[model samples]
Target: MRKLGTVLAALLVIMTAGWAGNAEAAKGIVIDGSTTVGPIAKSFAAYFMKKYKVPVTVSESGSGNGAKSLINGSCDIADMSRSMKPQEIAAAKARRINPVANVVALDCLAMIVHPSNPVRALTEAQIGDIFSGRINNWRQVGGPNFPIVVIQRESNSGTQETFKELVMKGRAVVSGAETQASNGAVKNRVSQTRGAIGFVGLGYLDASVKKIAVNGVIPSAATVKNKTYRLSRDLYMYTNGKPAGVVGTFIDLPKTPDGRRIIQELGFVPKY
Candidate 1:
């Protein structure tokens, strides 16, 4: 009888330890960086935490900050708008942090103008001129009589980098341009202010503002998937060293149908 009691107590101890281990494994996931990728990351974090019953937190400072946080071991995942730079990758390697990038979504830089503006499309060169302040009047682009109000993302913005690389080619965005923090902010300002032009992610588009076609090319999923959307870029989640635990599970999310649905419905293309 004493022997049986000992065995039962040992079993109870093992069971309690197992449960504790499982609880720790499902604790939480931390994500940070990239305002351009913020909406998508938030969406994924919400869905993932609810589905897996694991807590998750996400923050957006910028892609550079995200990469830095990942290298510093402060975040489980880092959201990014562009691929890692060579120097960033080298830095990560020095810290023994291998950043495995999982492409989660695609976004088109939706160049927006106030609804009152008649300019429905812009050539790439015309856009360059407008943002550079070389063309300040709407009439320069065969539009209204008002002068154009150029809006831009802050310099630290990942979207800004992508825009510069893909469109501006390192030429400075106009000196007096208004700089906003997030895509939503840019959309709101352009929506309410006539003659204002700004760029935002396609997910933020609405009838309140008009999205201009760049070089006669419309921003759409089909165009982006086919590599025709000139201002499109891939959204990424960077995990340190191929990931583990909740981070690893979340990284594999795009492989599921529900994940893909969320990606497309958010106005971004899914990584195939």
Candidate 2:
């Protein structure tokens, strides 16, 4: 009888420990999505974790994957550079997941090139032609004699979709163009390769690459906010529903002064 009692107590203790471990594991937030929004998500996660002592995991596997994670009950937040498409919403509904979009910031898709390239601005048609196979040489756009290396983000990327809609205007990117997985990769490739041209979120811009004007208008916070920049788009975060608890607070951070500062410092335009 004593042996049976002892074994029962031991089982109770083990069960309690297992429950505790599961609770701890579920305490943090999981964020995954666009490389364009990855920097902002990382910054917000750092700030939230430091302030609240909560664990946060952030991944930039592309917006399409992020939506999949949310629908599959894997991630708490989906950081997307573009709004979720209709098919994504339909898929989520089928799985009983209600994906809700939260606007985080504004971004301008900046056309970038190596600093050595002297060409300053491009019209919409010229930009479209360059990305398509029509214009192959840099000299055609009044630049160097080298061949224009067109760099683009992979098909899974929200940035790629936005570029296709806004810049490509229904035209396909040339098959011969190089495809990178992330915004940083595209920036790096353009910065290192002479006569290369690429587009990246405004947050990824730096001295290594020169941002050329599109239609005589340079991309900047002011230009993007005022709707003057042709490539501007709103950044987004999607939750399963109206977020509650830590997820709600984290998504609301952009409305705060500190969050607004962080957004601007990262080269994205704040909501306010």
lDDT of each: 0.87, 0.93
Could you tell me which 10 consecutive residues in candidate 1 have the lowest summed lDDT? 21-30
lDDT of 1 by residue, 118-215 (tens): 88889988999998889999998999789899999987778888888888887888899999988888999999999899998878888888988888
Measured against the true structure, the TM-scores of the candidates, in listed sequence, are 0.88, 0.91
Q: How does residue 129 of candidate 1 score in lDDT?
A: 93
lDDT of 1 at 6: 100
Error of model 1, residue 46, in angstroms: 1.7
Q: What number of clashing residue pairs does each candidate have, in the order they appear? A: 1, 0
Per-residue lDDT of 1-272 in model 2, one digit per residue for the tens?
Answer: 99999999999999999999778858999999999899999999999999988888999999999988999989999999889999999999999999999999999899999999999999878999999979999899888789999999998999999999997888889999999999989999999999799999999999999999999999999999899889999999999999899999999999999999999999999986
Model 2 TM-score on a 0 to 1 scale: 0.91
Give the distance in Å from residue 94's predicted Cα in candidate 2 to where it truly belongs.
0.5
Give candidate 1 misplaced runs (Cα > 4 Å).
1-26
lDDT of 1 at 65: 93
* Candidate achieving the largest TM-score: 2
